[model samples]
Target: LRETRSYTWGLVIPDLTNFGFASIARSLEAHCREAGIQLLIACSEDDPALEQRVVDNLISRQVDGLIVASSGHSDDIYARIHDRLPVVQLDRHIGESRLPMVISDACKATAELVRDMASECGAEIYYFGGLLDLSPSRHRLAGYELGLHRAGLEADPARVRHRDYQPSSGYQLMAELVAELGAPPRGLFTASFTLLEGV
Candidate 1:
């Protein structure tokens, strides 16, 4: 019998204030500690350039592996790190880069939320924030559509306002939904936690 040990891993996340990513980081840190491996954590503030710098810094620190919470411009960073080391994508996946990923079932959750909104409130739903270029937003939208269909409602592309996931963008999108949909959507789905706060 052989005793298994954890490997030192570097975690690059979007923001520390991001509860979802933080929760994942905290869990991973505990796991690493238990396994006697060091965990290095870095935050990018959703900036690709910053992410790249952090990745370089972490690599230089001689971490055994890496985990990145994907964000805009992350694809480029992943591309740069693709073969240099073994990297896991936490919370987002890169198809071409072949990075292992752990993420929420956004598609399933979206469908469920939309269905609930439709059934409970007969409420028109509008998903705001984040361009489809991002993973979570896209999956959530797909889920929203599924939920709409389940509720015997149709999706109106106009109702969905995709933009940078920010407080200002959410506020603007909310305004648009109010004007275009003839009312604010009874249910609003936001892509990022900050966007959720904005709403």
Candidate 2:
């Protein structure tokens, strides 16, 4: 009564160059290949419009499912796609939608790590983060604050920077901190590997 399955899955990521995303795509492709499924990977380059076009293109090709690390611009497209196909949000998500998500628990881990940094340094700790529009960033920030609280320290509002998840943003934030203090930070926590690479 129905057409044969395409045996193909689409994966859309914000940045294919990112190591984490690349590894995911690589692992998934391997698995899909072993299962006799073709994996179609697309890079959004962190643009919502580009993401839309790729998703549409994948759908046109009749992909069996999709794994998206969205740009956090909106939920309309993913939600619409989910109606007819299985859409799984990976790494990042727009919000809590009906669709399922596979995300890292950056919150608890961040908090613990920050606490360790505070305890070891016994001084003011600075946080460098990425855009709060995504869930991972928000969770990491909360975790940083929680870590400081656990260490009997307070988060210095002035020392926290929430910029985009780019190497340039990381560099800029580091420069700003150094300029303001006229010295490098003693206790520093960089969230997001891209930001870490930047700083």
In terms of TM-score, the best-performing candidate is 2
Candidate 1 C-alpha error for residue 20, in Å = 1.0
List the candidates' TM-scores in order: 0.83, 0.93
Residue lDDT tens for model 2, 130-169:
7787788889999999999999988879878888878888
Model 2 clash pairs? Answer: none
> In candidate 2, which residue ranges exceed 4 Å CA deviation?
1-3
lDDT of each model, Cα atoms only? 0.77, 0.87
Candidate 1 lDDT (Cα, 0 to 1): 0.77
| Candidate 1 wrong stretches, greater than 4 Å | 1-7, 72-84, 175-184
The CA root-mean-square deviation of candidate 2, after full C-alpha superposition on the true structure, stands at 1.7
Best by lDDT: 2
Report the Cα lDDT for residue 129, model 2. 87
